[model samples]
Target: MPYSSLPPSAFWKLCRNDRDFLLSDIYQPKFSLTPGMRIATAGSCFAQNIGRYVRASELELVDTEPAPALMPAETAQRFGYGLFSARYGNIYTARQLRQLLEDAVGDRLHDCTLWQRDGRFYDGLRPNTEPEGLGSEDELRAHRLDHLRRVRAIFDTADVFVFTLGLTETWTDTDTGVVFPTAPGVIAGQFDPDRHAFLNLGMGETLEDLSAAITLIRELAPEIRILLTVSPVPLTATASGHHVLRATTYSKSVLRAVAEEVAALDPGIDYFPSYEIITGTPFGARNYKDNLRNVTTEGVQRVMSVFFGAHDGLAPVDRPDTGLARPSSDPDEEDAVVCEEAMLEALAPK
Candidate 1:
């Protein structure tokens, strides 16, 4: 029988001896990151790993919502930044993120009203926590206006926006078209048909929205480059009708495709194939960590290998002209140990 007409089993058997068939394409590259580069990270929990690994290397990692006095974990929980930074608040889908940027840029502005009080602005949705009961409508509006201004400031200052595309499905306000961080029921809210709707973006729609976001970011800060990745961590749950396992596959496939599409369309935008590096068979059957859901150090190393290799042979980025000498090697090691201890302490039950 001709190869083209052979059944699937026969085809597999014939190619069984091709040792280089799958392995040939799995190359890991080296990445050279400069010190003092201001990079902001957002997306799912897996994306947070980049911040941890980068900061651990003693490079300058930017956190827009830096906590004042709280320890690492407390700062993360209170201000919603770090390790699991929710800087923009649960941007699980590209549509939600795009909508956020659009709103920030004064395009596709939602009807949501904002007001100011006591020198602070608040969105109508986010309430003020004080000894008194819920704040008056005027007070809530003020807080929201202030929040919007702060969010804009973040966009203005960031040099690199490292966005990890997570999911393709989202729940949005039907009338206002405002995308919610979570589904209506999961959070303290109801989704009336007249006011809410669900969106499951296809590959094209995802790319379109992401492209718009990139354009908007450049308008705000033209120097800002975008590094896009697909989160490898599987979904905890899916609103899709399929079983959780199948939904994970569906969601990841869609998001990965979108990342590639957008990267191809723009030069400043780069796609780091972190998803393939971690989940691909080359890593073998072992889970990266004790928490199998999270990618392990070995997995991360593999991703970085490609990152470095891709920029191979280029001169190392020069240290910023600031007269600060590199921190001493021995002291740096000790600081890492201390930081790790502090991380653990911060995470202790409070």
Candidate 2:
């Protein structure tokens, strides 16, 4: 009965219900994000939400690869323009992200990771960036080169970098072990079992890959702070042959753990609980659309509100359901979360 009976964080016992507990600020960031800070985001498709949301706020979200001055908004988004700091689309794994920067700085080319469709070539790394295929193999190469140069510039100048970890399962080239965001044929490449292999990364490999990514980013931009979040959206399909439900659990668990390990390495690195905010039991899955995989607009606002609260000296724990945004059944909506992994289902044979 005495106050000495329990340890820290046990205050949840005081809550008569779960919602009160879920709103607590699990994130106390080591770095502050203020207006004019150049925050470049990457990683899973869920990350795309940050750019849209931050632009609507006071923070200075940088777009290193801005669309041509008069480019249409819809057109700009489709060609992988104005999405992240660069044109790189949905970097699903840490190795893919690390290798991207590696290629940018050292010119360690992985050019063979390309796909051909109807006489046009696509960057296997970002097959969907170009809605159609590039005019020629040379065109693909030229665009990729320019993208890399901007990526390097982004890394060198950003005050903060945010990345969302999406999955642990990936398809890679058997000979070279290069990772692909989607299976080859799904978007543009031919899926060949002989040439391509499936890899379901474990905690150790994910940890190592992320460690390398953090190290490389810090080495290039010593003052840049890193923020990492695991996407809460479930996997659309699994090559691991496990039920998507089980696969989702494993994938998220590995990423969440590895993120913590990486964050412990540096004071500037942090892991935000966007994944937990939506997936946590207390929220009761209120954040998902009917499909249960696509996070709703309300959910994105909810997550970002919590994000703003913990950083930038904003109020941290108020859960007023402000109609700050509207919900959508459509993933194509502007400011919608862009999760290319969802394409796996649309690719399934009817």
Candidate 3:
């Protein structure tokens, strides 16, 4: 049962926890991270944790989303949480991210235009921002060219690309073949069967798409290392119609398999089993929060415990200064109770 006695190939399986083992042995700051490194993250909500963790560790985390002027709590409440970063917008699957990259690269075959409606410009893919204006065809083309330039700039400056591969099924534009984070119906529009098709990418298809994405990233930043994780959060809904619960299982299974396959295929790519660390049977089943859905702090701690154990020498991060001070408990103060309650509730939770 000794860890050193295990064969090198069997180490990951026999380890008490892979995340901790990998962090301690392979991903320590001394070995895996260095000063002045720029890292970018995109994926599910769990992926946001990477940004949070890195920032907490006093490492540089690039924020690609436009920040609002309001305070963090106000911004989060108004935006439904995790503002100052693009969190809620579903990057549900790797294919969706791949398409975004393709669009950014101008390799997309479709003639797409950035349009303005309600005073903001929208990237037809995810309507995260308002359209600036509907310019002439030539003007719109120029804008897209500028947008792509900015994306390329970020890609070039990043030292690590942390992408969380979320879902395999996605909704694509019928005529243009552009992919959407959620199908038309789920968020705002009608689901036209004729125009949209569900993509349940098989192993080979997923590998090819991921490989292509890696190639594209290398073209932009040759030294970038990709860390891919399968989100452990269960799906809120499934298009497969095989009972929502069953759909969650099916989706996670496919994604986990694809992640393992892709990691095996490339040396520059690494797989982190954060999904298994939290949801695997080894942790037992009662670890979720009251909703019996979301993972609890204990669950998170278990994952981080493994992570820290693996990366043994990382100095503990100093407490974060979110720049928003703790609200006073004075009842007469406007919004004071809100902030106080928020702080209390966060700490009150087990």
Report the number of the highest-TM-score candidate.
2
- What ranges in model 3 sit over 4 Å off? 1-4, 7-31, 64-73, 76-88, 107-124, 128-148, 318-350
- For each candidate, the alpha-carbon lDDT, in order, equals 0.56, 0.80, 0.57
Better of 2 and 3 by lDDT: 2
Q: Please identify which of the two predictions, 1 or 3, would achieve the higher lDDT against the true structure.
A: 3
RMSD of 3: 7.9
- Model 2: residue 276 alpha-carbon error in angstroms: 0.8
Ten consecutive residues with minimal summed lDDT in candidate 2?
315-324
lDDT tens digits, residues 122-203, model 1?
A: 3323211121222565554444444455556766666667888887776677667677655553323344667667677777
Q: What is the TM-score of each predicted model, taking all chains together?
A: 0.68, 0.90, 0.72
Q: Which ten residues in a row have the lowest lDDT in candidate 3?
A: 336-345
Q: Give the CA lDDT, 0 to 100, for residue 302 in model 3.
A: 58
- Sort by TM-score, best first: 2, 3, 1
Instruction: Point out the higher-scoring one by TM-score: 2 or 3.
Output: 2
After TM-score superposition, the amount by which residue 11's alpha carbon in candidate 1 deviates from its true location, in angstroms, is: 18
lDDT tens digits, residues 50-161, model 2?
7776666666677888989887766677778777888888998887887787888886557557678899988888887886988888788888888888888897678889
Residue 159 of model 1, lDDT score? 67
